[model samples]
Every structure is written in structure tokens, then in C-alpha cells.
Target: MQLLYEHRSPPRTGRKVALIITGALMVVALLIFPPEGLVTTWSLWALACALQLAGVGLLALPPVIHLWITRREIIIHPTGPVRRLPIQHIHDMELSGTEEDPVLTLHLRNGEELDLSDWTDNVPEVMALLAQLGVARRDA
Candidate 1:
């Protein structure tokens, strides 16, 4: 029996808030520093420019939006390098570490292992998934 499910992670607004704050500060700085003057070099305007680019670049990073898993495989999208393992190839499922920051490990064939705890936002959902997949879910 093989079943797969997908769950969209929660929205993370901290980045948006950070971008807004930084943009506002940059506008204020530009207004005060006057881009026309040679004083830009002396007043660290270059630093502001670098920071703005970095902030915008970070927005391109894809969040942990979807997790697709079945007893045989697990996929994380939209940047998935899907791992395909049959149920028989999954040796064991383990949960370790502190309650607040526990780790979930799936021991696979040929000494391979999978850890999904890092980017996972909702642990309870994953735990339920593991149970459904006959993983013998562990209490964190």
C-alpha cells in the first residue's frame, strides 16, 4: 500500500517585515544623505546599497512550502531533489534531540538516511504521516 500527501507550510512574514523596515530606513537615509553629493562615499552609502541588494536577494529564497511524503518516498518542493525509497528500503524511523528541537530520521537502504526536521514547520502533521506510513512514530 502506497499513499502520498502534500502539506503547504505556514507563511513566514518576518522577512517581509524586515524588508519593509530596511527599505524605510534606506529611504530616510537617502533623503538625508542626498545621492548627488560626493559625501556618499564618506557616509557609508555603499554599505546601504549592499544591504539593499542582499535584502532583495534573500526574498528569492523559496520557503519550505510543500512536503510530499509516502511510506516509500519523501519530497520537498519547489526545490525538490526527490528521494525514492521503497518501503522495504526504509530501515527505521527515529526521533531524537530535545522536545522543542527534536530530530526525525529515516534510516534507509545502503546506509542512507533522511532528516526532515530542520525545515519542517509542523511536527505533529509529520508525526501523523509517519504513523500512517507504518513508521511507528516516536514521542518527542
Candidate 2:
């Protein structure tokens, strides 16, 4: 079967806003008082701003990172690591009830359950996508 619905976590707007504000403040500070002494430097402050900006940018992107689902297997990339699980290995899929109680538990053939809640958005569309992927509610 063809790969279908895809889902991701919500954009980290609050973190982005905080990063932008901090970067702006750092820029203003650097402009007002440029670093002079070797010990008392503004480089660290600049680096911090850059790192925060990078973090916010990464957070705004999809949390799925990498996903490929086929008739045989499903692969997920979380950070630099990759996990590939065959469809035949999956026994059951469980979807959590509410946003506050969000979770996706995958029961594997090996009797191991993997939770995929942190990688998806808490939305109805996402829930529907899970259902389409054969993830049924535990209560159901």
C-alpha cells in the first residue's frame, strides 16, 4: 500500500519567540558595548544567541524527523538515530484518549510496546491519521 497520512508535533512558537527576544537583546547589548577584554567577552553571549536560534528553528520543524511506511515496515528517525520496525512485527496500535493524555503505544510481536506520543501533534487530524495507520483507541 502507498504511504498515507503524516503527522508532526506543533510548532514551538513560544520557544521561537523567546529565542528571538533573547537574540535581539544580545544584539542590542553587543552594539551598545562591544567586547573589549579577553576575559570579559561578548562572544559567549553571541554564541548562546546563535545556539538558541538554532534550537528554536529545529523545534519549529516536524518532530517526526524521518518516517517511511510501506506494506512491510515503518521507519522512524528520532534525532540522529533511525529505527526500523517491520509491519509484521506490530501486534497492536493504541491511541490515547485526550490531548493532555496523549500517547501512541505500539505493541510489537516481541511483546514490547513503543510509545510515540512525543513525536506527534495533539490534534484530531493527527488522531485520524493514527486511525488510518491502524492505530485504534485502547478503549475501542
Candidate 3:
């Protein structure tokens, strides 16, 4: 596939590693002190577990943080299963929301509309690219 446009977010690997380390330290601290009260111990354990789980979840997430459009498809790089949308399947592109917080909506041929507000901030640029690729906007 021909490369059209790409936008990426900075890496958060270091932050995720730090979170995992912090959670591990919490676990160690709980083991050493064994909180005085039963309720406190349980609370500490819960916190430790939550921290560890959150760290692991973050680590599992995909690193790509923006939309990647090619000649054939629009690849959404978010934490989800439906990542690729074919260009041919897109019926129209629509922009909504306030000017300060614009949202790009993809109206699929099957009638499913995808709100891309959360995935991308470069709304106008993306809209332009899609238009150049011959994907008509809703008004057109």
C-alpha cells in the first residue's frame, strides 16, 4: 500500500515501566510492613493489585496513537479490534462538534458512523487528505 499520511504520538514506554516498578515497590512495602489493621492490610493489598493491573494493561496497549491512512484503507490506531476501515467502504466524511473541539465522523457504506474525535486532533488535515483521495464529504 502506498503511504499517504501518518501522525504518531510520543512513546510512553518509560512511563509504563515506571508504573510497573512503582506497583512492585508497593507490593514489597506491604509485605514488609503488613499494615497494622486488618482493614488497612486489605486496602493496601487492593491498591497494590489495582496498580499492578493498571500497569500491565497500559503495557498491553498498542503504541500507535493516531490515524494512518493509505491508498486503500484508514487504519485507526486505538485500543480496539476494528482497526482498519477500507476506503471504498466509507460513504462520506463529516466534521462535527464545536470549532475548538472538532470531530471527524466516517459514515460507512453499511450505515455505521465512526466518531474519530478521540483518535485524532488534526481533523482538518485528515479531512483534506481523505478528500484528495476521493472520499467525498457529507456536504459534497
Top lDDT hit: 3
lDDT of 1 by residue, 1-140 (tens): 34456666554557655765776687677778667657764465666666667666766665554566766666656356654556566666778877888777777767887787864756667767766777654343
How many residue pairs clash per model? 0, 0, 0
Error of 1 at 48 (Å): 3.2
Candidate 3 structure quality by residue, lDDT tens digits, 1-140? 77687767766888888878888999999888787998999998888888888888988876675777898998887344548998999999998788899989999999899987777778898899999988988862
How do all the candidates rank in terms of TM-score, highest first? 1, 3, 2
Measured by TM-score, the strongest candidate is 1
Give TM per candidate: 0.59, 0.51, 0.58
Worst 10 residues of 1 by lDDT: 78-87
Among residues 3 or more apart in sequence or in different chains, the pairs in candidate 3 whose N, CA or C atoms overlap within 3 Å are none
Q: Write the per-residue lDDT of candidate 2 for residues 41-140, one digit (tens) a residue.
A: 6565767578677767776676445454555566676355878887667777776667677677778879898876655444455446556666555554
CA lDDT of every candidate: 0.65, 0.65, 0.84
Which wins on TM-score, candidate 2 or candidate 3? Answer: 3
Superposed by TM-score, candidate 3 places the C-alpha of residue 105 at a distance from the truth, in angstroms, of 0.5
